[model samples]
Target: MPHYKKTKIPLLWLRRHTSDREFMLISSVLVGLTAGMAAVILKTLVHYIHVLLAYGNRLLDQPYWLVVFPIIGILLTVFVVRVAFNGSIGRGTAGVLFSISQKSSMVERHKMYSHVVTSAFTAGFGGSAGLESPIVVTGSAIGSNYGRDYHLNYRDRTLLLAAGAAAGIAAVFNAPIAGVLFAIEVLLTDISISAFIPLIISAVVGALCSKLILQEEILFNIGQREFFAASHLPFYVLLGVLCGMMSVYYTRMALRVEELFEEYQSKVYSRAIVGGILLGLLIMLFPPLFGEGYDSIRLLEGNNAQEMLQNSWLAFFGTNEWLVLCFVGALALVKVFAATITIASGGNGGNFAPSMFVGASTGFFFSRLVNLLSFNNLPVSSFAMVGMAGILSGVMHAPLTAVFLIAEITGGYTLMIPLMIVAATSYAMVKYFEPYSLDTKKLAQKGQLLTHNKDRTILRIMKIQHLIETEFQPVSPEATLGELVEVIAHSRRNLFPVVTADRKLDGIILLENVREIMFKTEKYDLVKVRELMVKPPAIVQYDDSMADVMKKFDESGAWNLPVLRNETYQGFVSKSSIFTKYRKLLIKTTNVA
Candidate 1:
């Protein structure tokens, strides 16, 4: 022992000295820096791809090539997903949500970079989608894998995963506060006040990264907005209503198109070609639908209406302003199709930016239409700004996020009042028609969504198979009490299932019921197992949901219940085991560490 030398394990030594909170704070900074860098790389890649495609070879001058580029992008993206990545590159934020709810927030390691590569190819070549969702997935994977490598607990892993997502969004938009809200509103459910410190730190770090390195241009730079006009409150309310209705139509149409493509799931090429061709034709008609369409939104906010229509098929109509207005309005309606097809056709992207694009267009269209009527001079730029909040609120069902995001990204709260009004109204209207957002409807329907509710989340993570007690021995109903006594002596469980020769549950024999006669040797021969066995008041089916099983337990008032499948005795489900598992799952689901 005196001759041996020990090698110091730095991480383990640090872990032994540092507290959990200190470790989380350190992890948050690392996640924020990495996620921010990832976001920057994705943006830079997409920009270079766009330059190479549109400006490098005179592709912009060739309208046919512009249409063909997206098809090629979709093909490339599909190829990479199917071959290079083994078809594991997930679809944007939905994948993130699915992982948190169903997979314990454990994202596949490939996602950390797969989305950046494929989405760059898809949108860089002009697929009509946005990079925000892909960035979210990539960042989430980074944080999740980091936590896994460190062997952190589930709560810490999920917190870090969400921190990465917030960081990515903050870096992308240069809006730290909004980033925090987006993470809490969309990705997390049951956040404590203590969690806010890490989230805030990560978001700020990410935003600083974007501000310092990327120098991101202000997305909707509408000069200095006019002060809110109380007279225009009614108009804002009406805009909210219209945006809500449009959101419903948009949600339904997107799901419908996704279903249409899903039919060709077995044939990836068929799906890719069909969706790409349709999207290409749409883009050919409406060049503004070519990509995320943020350029067009900026143009619209700046009142460059003619420039917005400069390169579209609609330009053939005329230079008439009314014609341009009609074209812009039409783009608002069909952009949904372009965006949805871009994604449904196996492109890697999300509906976040597309929704904002639609909102801006809708707001501008409404304001222009009213101004043309001469009812009043509505501020087109302000309405366009608030409209972003309205549609975002409706589609994502996160009104606060929509409102604050609009306020923060625009670099001021000049439109906060209208933002709140429009966002709340649209959210309420959409909530009336659709109970869940586009990303969460399927998960909620399957009872897989883990909201902030601790009880439901605990129940959601508790699997019945893990709680099933298979050690309970079974005996034939035809056996004598002597055989039951032998089983009871050799077994540990107090309840013994009586089954037929076919393994079907005929009844059960409780040890307490035969406790006195169990040791009576004379009665063991005379009393048959069937004579003493009693039918259980209630039985649990193998496929029954936890909610239903809990209800059966309460109604039967039994400590132990028999589990059966098609009348065959499978095993027993004891209350003690369920309680123990519930406590463990509760700790796993709720513990912040």
Candidate 2:
């Protein structure tokens, strides 16, 4: 529900008149308008940057400047990050996922505009990355910060954040359904019926913003002039498989190269310089590897498919048909390198466009190869479009988003069957090899990712260190029963850990075992902690997962267990404490962002 007291004067009147659902619905429209405008503005900014370079600027009039511009973009972005943003700006979708997990559904205010500015400079100057991720980041931050200012809870705030993301994507692609699905599939762990209204409203509003504000040329729309052939199902299956393989390669290569650049974390300038130079070299060799590559993807559907070769080093040779095919294939393979360097070197961008670019190239190359080598003629444009779905499905692990997005952007669902087939095929194949998508992999490794599994997700967010109970008094094994009783008088906890002189966990003493002896003052001086204490049913390792902790709790059937670090007793972890923390976190994390 919208909080009137916490909010400003303008929204307080609406908050008083309407219920929670109505307020959210109304807010969804506002969020859509705002995020949609943001998306439109970002697109306009990139377009103007491109125009400034192409028409007005003679500095880049020379063809070779194409190679140099990406490097400059990287350096400029790095400088901006170091100076304007305090030398730290998280890049891509991973940062958003991290914010969702670690932050209580509250994105920093800077993210609302930071991503737009950085991505504009990065992509505007021909960095081989996509603006979609930045759009998502910016839009989500807007929603999150809005929710925070209005004092919304984590659930409603997260929903709004996703609405903003959906709005941004819908605006960019003019595909409302795709935007909603992308938010659902990629961002949220679970959803309720109430969530859909805001998502749908936001997406429609975003799409409207795109329709009203942006021209047809700046959009990512592709004209699908061909029909899907069931007879070509076998070819699509092969293409799906190819896209799946390429997706794995793309993910692995990107992660691997980013690791290489990670070594130069402290040396941002030298790294950017080297990475920029290499990126420029790659862009020089393959002009299509520059920027979002949407133009080149669009070009692949036409007779001038080879025309992308005009500004490239390959232009020295004639545009042979086979050479064009190979060139497209090379673009598919090497574009990841260009994108990885662009981002790893400190420029802001994402793999969304690169995946689509690769998929399109893969599809074009496959269809062209088939037509050249075999008797049957394949529809190159259809293959190119479906191939985009394939890569998006595999890379993002969002088959529905890829399917509907391609369908919506291309004007209709004429290729729905092929879209589904390729999307499903690629997703299945990639899943068998890599369980996590490119964005969530790092979080998964750190046990910070939220999944569809409610119990698992809750446990992943629960840290053992946070649940440890140190209030329980520790008794030395050599301590007499009277001394133990003295210590026990102060501690509220019934369970006690027995420690040696070296502070190693010798054993544990349950209150039930000591109840009989504690009252018998005659035996208090005679009994030692070593003799009274016995081995606990189980000991919890310091680094154990919360799931493992729960497992030990169940297996031992004990309410408390000793937590140990290198065999030394740190503290006791009680089932009650864990359950308390669990219930608290469960409320915050369930069906969250």
Candidate 3:
């Protein structure tokens, strides 16, 4: 038998030869390519599923089939999650954000393909949702796990995570610029200019994958059009306001519906059944609500709004264009319900596509209404295209991403001015009512949102338990000065906690305060620990937040603070320890590596 020894290279060799930037750039490419491939596969799977289930089929002609297919898709998705994946659908983008903020940019390894399988099943089988979000999750997981495998630091891991997300979004839409902005605006909070290189590289590679392999058509192509005239500015602004209002409604509705489903949290099947039935009925009345509604958006963009309403029950109200316009507007209003229910019912998907769908519908309805009632020939296609940016901006609180994504996908900067106007106006208006985007609200509330602000992000990641020094010895308040002297000699710390017989904190004794009497051993018997101990300016409760702890530290001007639980001494939290931990956390959170 021949024994083979594995060849090994020194870790120092790799670290010495390669710069961190080069390694990150290389990793970004791999992540981009892999994530791009995943996006293509997910999109292709959904296309084939649509072809098999609904396209060119008599089943789609029946209104009842429309009602049944979504139910079946959701049930299949639920089955896959419960049986194969152990009832974990994987948190979509929120999960990605949470990982970046709280989990040290670490995601479950299974997420790389779990979302692909589940979301493909959900959306492909006619569930009313989009694949963009799942792809983002899948991509982020790929990047996160790849970084983890290499034993990369938290900063590099988070950078790769965002790179993967950028690639996924870029590949899905074939819009690389939008992908970069999406990653920067939504996923990455603390980024450096150098970080953009990897993100850009990843996005371009991902977009190339979609363009070269998948040959994905430009999703919403609004053919050559002139820039919006100054005359149309007011209408665009008005449209922005309307979209902003719709965005608010969409956010509130999605959150409320999610809460409603959560009421049956333990009863997954009941939630699925009730949500599916409700979603089905909505689709039955408004056929456009059946799936992602991208096709309906395309119809509106092509000035075929009537075609969207053709299969609806309202088609009986004659082929009236106004009725169709009204129905389109109604779909814009209720599409939020369809989308929220689709996901809330245990289906796998995200709001990325639904937001664009609602935006397109709102723009088309607004433009069409103006064209009918006024002499101004408001370009419906342009508004339809720009409306997507507005709703996307408002819903995601990502105006830059929305604007660039629309400008890129539409194949020109012809609509750039209106896109900016509408998106900015809508975002500003929505910001007045909702501080955080739909995806980030919960994370922000929990202090798990990694914003661009470095200080806050570091503070959020710094755990008080890890910073607390529990090694300080506690001296009984009744202990004689000679006993205190013995404790001080054995202890490594300069501060001592004086506790009662029951372990409750009485006061703290600083070594400096007793330094004068330390050498007077003859008088040691005359001094008692309680007599020398002084009350601290402030004490930190065990459950006190880091913010409160810091505040107490500032107000008291103490080098060390006692941590107590219900008046019982727990440990000592030092200002120096906190500053050291914060410095380390800041380095870890930022792209210092």
lDDT per model vs. reference: 0.84, 0.87, 0.85
lDDT computed for candidate 3? 0.85
Between candidates 2 and 3, the lDDT winner: 2
Listed per candidate, the RMSD to the true structure in angstroms reads 3.8, 2.8, 3.3
Candidate 3 lDDT over 1-593, as tens digits, reads 22211211333355457888777777788899999999999888888888787765768888888778888888888888899888885668898888876788899988899899888878876788888899999999988988886778887888888899999999988899999999989888656787899999999999999888874442434454556788999999999999899999999999999998888888888888787888889999999887777788778778888887678888888769789888988989889999899999999999998999999999999999999998589988889889999999999999999999988877889888889999999999999999889998877777777654557656765667777788999999888899999999999888999988898999989999998998899978888999999998898888888888999999999889988887878898998988988887665656423
Total clashes, candidate 1?
2
Extract clashing residue pairs from model 2. Answer: none
lDDT of 3 at 126: 75
Q: Candidate 1 on 1-593: residue-level lDDT in tens?
A: 33212222454565578998898898898899989889888888888788777778878777887668888899999999989888758777778887886677899999999999999988998999988899899889988987887788788999999999999989888888888888989888668899998888888988888788874443233354566899999999999998999888788888998888888888888788888889888888888888778888887787677787778776777668688778888988998899999999888899888899999899999988999889889998888888888988998888888888888877788789999999999999999999889877767767666654557655655666777888888988889989899999899888889888898998999988999888889887788999989999799988887777888999999988989888877888988888888787666555353
Which predicted model would earn the best TM-score? 2
Poorly placed runs, candidate 2 (over 4 Å):
1-7, 58-61, 451-454, 485-492, 518-520
Tens digits of per-residue lDDT for model 2 on 157-223? 9889999999999998999999999999988868887789899999999999999889988987877
Quality of model 2 by C-alpha lDDT: 0.87
lDDT of 1: 0.84
TM per candidate comes to 0.92, 0.95, 0.92
Off by over 4 Å in 3: 1-26, 215-222, 517-523
What is the number of backbone collisions in each predicted candidate, taken in the order shown?
2, 0, 1
